[model samples]
Target chain A: MTEKTLIDARGSFCPGPLMELIAQLKSAEVGDEFEVLSSDKGSANDIPEWVEKAGHELVESREDKGVWHITVKKKR
Target chain B: MRILIIGGGMGGTILANNLARRLSSEIKAGKVNLTMLSASEKHFYQPGLLYLAVGQMMPDELYREQVSLLEPGIAFHVDPVTEFHLDENQVKTQSDRTYDYDVLVIATGSRVNMEEIPGLAENAEMFYTEEGALKMLKSLREFEGGRVVVCVGVPHKCPMAPLEITFMMHDFFKERGILDKVELYYTYPIGRIHSLENVAKWATPEFDQLGIKYETFFNMKEVDGDNKILRSEEGAEVNYDLLVTIPAHKGMEVVESQGLGKDGWVPIDRLRLNMEGRDNVFAIGDTTNLPISKAGSTAHFEAEALGENIASMVKIGQPVRDYDGKVFCFIEAGKDRATYASFDYLNPPDPKPPTRAVHWFKVAYNQLYWASARGLL
Candidate 1:
């Protein structure tokens, strides 16, 4: 079974969501995917930008009902 | 109507965006022209410099192109204004271009005066600018352990920065397993290291817990670079193996040369934010010699009232509200914990206790600030 960690950073500020993602990514095994839910207007742009800069693969990103659902796959 | 904003730093950009948003109709109808004169094409998120010193943020992440953050309707001019002639209601740029405006907002901000303290520019590393922060970062990486003194030479921007550096250095040394080998010191001009009374009370115990020494009322006078000693005007001396000092800050030379300032600092009516003698010419942020922290947060607050007043003046030839001089700034206490303080002209600083969550909020603020600065937030 594939396990995915979920982080609900909705309503948190800009870097709050990004930092949470980084903190969770630290202990995740290689190939582990994490989905971060954020409501900050800047998170959609900030998270993907940081993920790319940190050499991680962004699996998918979608917005549902004013919330951003960003999924990332841990790539060593 | 022509609105010219000088200095595209924090205050200018925020004011421009707010004005653009408030007067979108007039702007679209070609009834008003709004132009911003910035010294460079880039706007530095200065509060992030402290983060850069500790390697928490990259240099490129702390700045954005000036034009990128402005609305398409606002004109962005990358040039430094050389002269402001209030008598003629005009400004002259270094490129020999002149811009006349019905209203002018001076947000040129402040600059460091390294020469104010002898041997400072020659020896110590600083974190006030991009170059200074990078140099300090390189020096910090090479530091093994020793006496590290963080000194504030004058009323510098971000009153909490020296304390942040002190706390962060202690944390940095601890993480490197050299905390025992390093002696940390924080020096400021006042009895309390911080300008805010409540924050000082909250940080005093933290200083003891972090093993950081606090030296008060020690205003820097000179630096003996060879011996690594800083002499204060109060006759106190601090020795350091590595020193990161905040140099004396002053208003821009252009503002002073134009006789718009006293002792290189522009004095404005705090509540009005208008030049002492000129109503159409206003000043905000570090450019004004206001008795408040020169942090961007204070400028952001001042811009709120100034923007409304400017908008009312542009529309009906009169201001609607008086500025409250409110300010709020977050203090990072290292180790993923931060606190914040809020104050106004009438109220003393009231600080919220430090917490890990607030630290995350500060981090989030750094990222959100870019979009917010562009008026997206």
Candidate 2:
């Protein structure tokens, strides 16, 4: 079964959003979908880069009212 | 006999590794055992984090696996200490496991107390932890144009960090093309910009050039988040759009509970680092109320003295070695330049001096210290 988790990093800055995502990814099962909510503009672009470089799958990404919603799936 | 060391920070880890290398012969002779207990499994290159905050380095570059840094025959315990039974000469972990030792070294570092001031932890941010630094970096990047206040609370670790943040913020604003719109202000409890006169000599010129306003002898009293104002104990109020504060520091709760720290920190003899009026107990790093700046370099120097003293105690059964209370601080001046100062209370012949060469020396010194501690060189 697949599960989904959301990390609200809206008020956090660059690596904060990415670090939150990583902490969530640690507890997440492979193929589990995790979404990160970040108000940092860099996170919208940087998270995808990290996910790809780390061999994780970026499920989806979007922006709403200055908050970026980025979803990723743990690959391993 | 086993030697137990608590707190695997700069002091504990360096001492453990140095002892392991220097005392291998004794260990082979079935004389001594060494163990280090720590809560975290990562050895942070904390000095580099200052660079990381300004996007100069990545997180991975500032930390390494703790297990990888330990030499053979040294035992590592990844656990938080629950209590210290000084009478029993043992420590109990959170899991109810107890370890007895012939000697105990307390190196548990200081803790940031954000709750000391109202709305500080609620609204203002810090730069001590990795999370805090990352959050601060994010905020600095998103900072477009506004009055940013860098406040230094009373008695904090790395006393120069707030000043460093101000210099970096000045550089950040200049690079973003908003130097004019952004007003930089610093409020500190100290009488001068830096405790050391040598560092103030180098830093004051940079502050003047950058137009960063600072108030010395202004003790931060409270944070009025609703009004965007920080009030000092002297009744002076400074208004700001964004506030970044270095909060007050305190000894670990465990230390306080065990009656180890009085006067806000563990009181140890400056010479031997042994707890006053206690046998077989020693302390190092920020945990001790040493009359010096609580910096990592101080901890590293103390650890060397401690390791040698511990070896002498175990091998020759001699009295502890004397610490000269020596310290050097690397002040990061903007424009990719830094200045260093050397101070030792006992060095009357060559009192504390500052040299331009010390600036470049600090860079090379860090690499040498790290490599030597990790046994890589």
Candidate 3:
């Protein structure tokens, strides 16, 4: 089942948001997509980079209301 | 214009992000190339390590990859600097790559000199690094209670850490119901408990309340790990079951070997952030002989002026900004409260009381540091 999961890491620092997303991805099915909402500016770049490195598909990444909404799908 | 910054710690990373944002046009136009050379990709939030040692923070919360904090357009290199060719405006890395820059910023910070005092390398557990802190944490958890000595070895990074750890240890033991059994000794090489007058005054009264035996003018000249005793040069000896110390700090070997600082630190114009006799080179953070507290806050404050100074000089051929040497740091006074201290070369704020709100603010600053590193805050 292709489901979307939301992980709000708004107040976390660098690697916190990344670590959260990775943890969620571990329990998430391969077809499931994970969206991370982070206020840290580093997340704008970090999330995408991690997704690519981990062989996950980066669905979309956008900035809204000073928060970064990054979506990634597990590939394996 | 090629701007190369050495050391990817707080100061270098912040400056890189700042330049990339302020000079986006130039960078996009291929007119300015901002590159940062970091020894590794790991960027540790060192302040959080103190909390980690006492089980107040998780291990994962203390660091992130350096590339995670840097923005686009800044070239990040993971190479240790081996030599500085200041005369040629170039630096050589351990990878044997030579980079020549129109302007260079040295932010390599300081290095711990464990060899300074005999037996220090083997005897002491430190909170200065992740591994050291974790070892101390494990030791603290297993041991029931005994004499725990926290020593300020020399002028080291984060001057408040020794005091902060001592305070945290007090709280840790008290919570475990072993406070009465544990004898805490805090020592510094200086004649006083603190360097700043206001900080000393603020912390002096709490010494008795915490049941801490604070000693001054006690320098660690040698350590006897077998007996777990620290010997001072002035014929003073302190016996402890657990020994924690802040080791001696010195500038990077590359900087000293190049004779850039003859004084074992990068010599720079304190206000200008420019290297002495080298207009195209600038030094910031713990790397320079700024005679200021080498805390992340100092680097954060210096980054504002140093970044602008670099941007102006690259665009207009002269720097327009001056650094005021402002430094702000939170001193955690155990029992869940912390105090905020802000000062500069000219002005020092009055000592303020510790509060839970300031402690929360300190945690917020840790979170906010991520954005600040990206120059977003």
**Local distance difference test, each candidate:** 0.80, 0.74, 0.80
Error of 3 at B179 (Å): 0.5
List the TM values for chain B, per candidate.
0.97, 0.93, 0.96
Local lDDT at B229 for model 2: 86
Top-scoring candidate (lDDT):
1
List TM-scores for all candidates, in order. Answer: 0.81, 0.78, 0.81
> Per-residue CA lDDT of candidate 3, range B209-236, in tens?
7789988756677899888889875568
Q: Where does model 3 exceed 4 Å of error?
A: A1-76, B262-264
**Chain A fold similarity by TM-score, each prediction:** 0.91, 0.91, 0.93
Candidate 1 error regions (>4 Å): A1-76
Predicted complex 1: DockQ: 0.01
Judge the docking of candidate 3 as incorrect, acceptable, medium or high.
incorrect
Can you tell me the DockQ of model 3? 0.01
Clashing pairs in 3: none
Off by over 4 Å in 2: A1-76, B347-369, B375-377
Evaluate candidate 2 and give its CAPRI docking class based on DockQ: incorrect
Q: Against the hidden true structure, what lDDT does model 1 obtain?
A: 0.80
> Each predicted complex: what DockQ?
0.01, 0.01, 0.01
